[model samples]
Target: MIRDGERVTLGDTAVTAHATPGHTMGSMSWSWRACQAMTCKAIVFAASLNPVSSDGYRYTAAASRPIVAGFRHSYRVMQSLPCDLLITAHADQDGATDRFRTAPGACRALAASSRTKLAARLRADGPAR
Candidate 1:
């Protein structure tokens, strides 16, 4: 598995991993630079923001307070990135696919928006007491 902040190179491009353990403890987001002709853009493949749990998943348990905190931390990390393109684990999360074709820097906006939304969600749901 790739560790957080580790950089892996593929051809001339290098991808850096950012740990975003909300959906799962090992969830990660990757950031890299992509070049097309004369254009070079920073891209981030964002990890899922949705909180997921199976029948026995710890996240669903009353003791999973840390997991909820982790999600908040991940959202903060994502908001701090300097990415020109932001692609989420789910396409509909940020309208990334369509925005990628029409607008650059959409990812930045999406990141901020996601952070805001997540904060509100967490506030409403509250951390496990």
Candidate 2:
């Protein structure tokens, strides 16, 4: 099992793994720096912040407390990442391929959006029974 805050090295590049378990219990995001001479840009392959799950799943239930906690932690992790370029688990999440430009602060935006989505889902979930 890969624990959170582990740095794995692939040849010359070391990628830091951050556990962002919103989409799933094992969801993760990878962060690394790519340098071109004097210019090094921070790249983050962010995990899917979407609350994708089965129809039977309800985030407000006591059973989902851990899941919701993970999501909250994930939001903080995503927001704190050093991201100069953004790539998400899904293409449409940030339009990773569209226009193809490095957008800083994307991680913060992604996390903020996830927070809103989670809030909406919780609202939709209604009061816990």
Model 1 lDDT-worst window of ten: 94-103
CA-only RMSD, every prediction: 3.5, 2.0
Stretches of candidate 1 above 4 Å error? Answer: 52-62, 94-105, 111-128
Cα lDDT over the full model 1? 0.71
Angstrom error at residue 82, model 1: 1.3
- Which candidate gets the maximum lDDT versus the true structure? 2
Residue-wise C-alpha lDDT for candidate 1, range 1-129, written one tens digit per residue:
779999999989999999987767788899898999999888888777765455444443477766777777787777687777767777566544442422555555665666666556556554444
Candidate 1 to truth, TM: 0.73
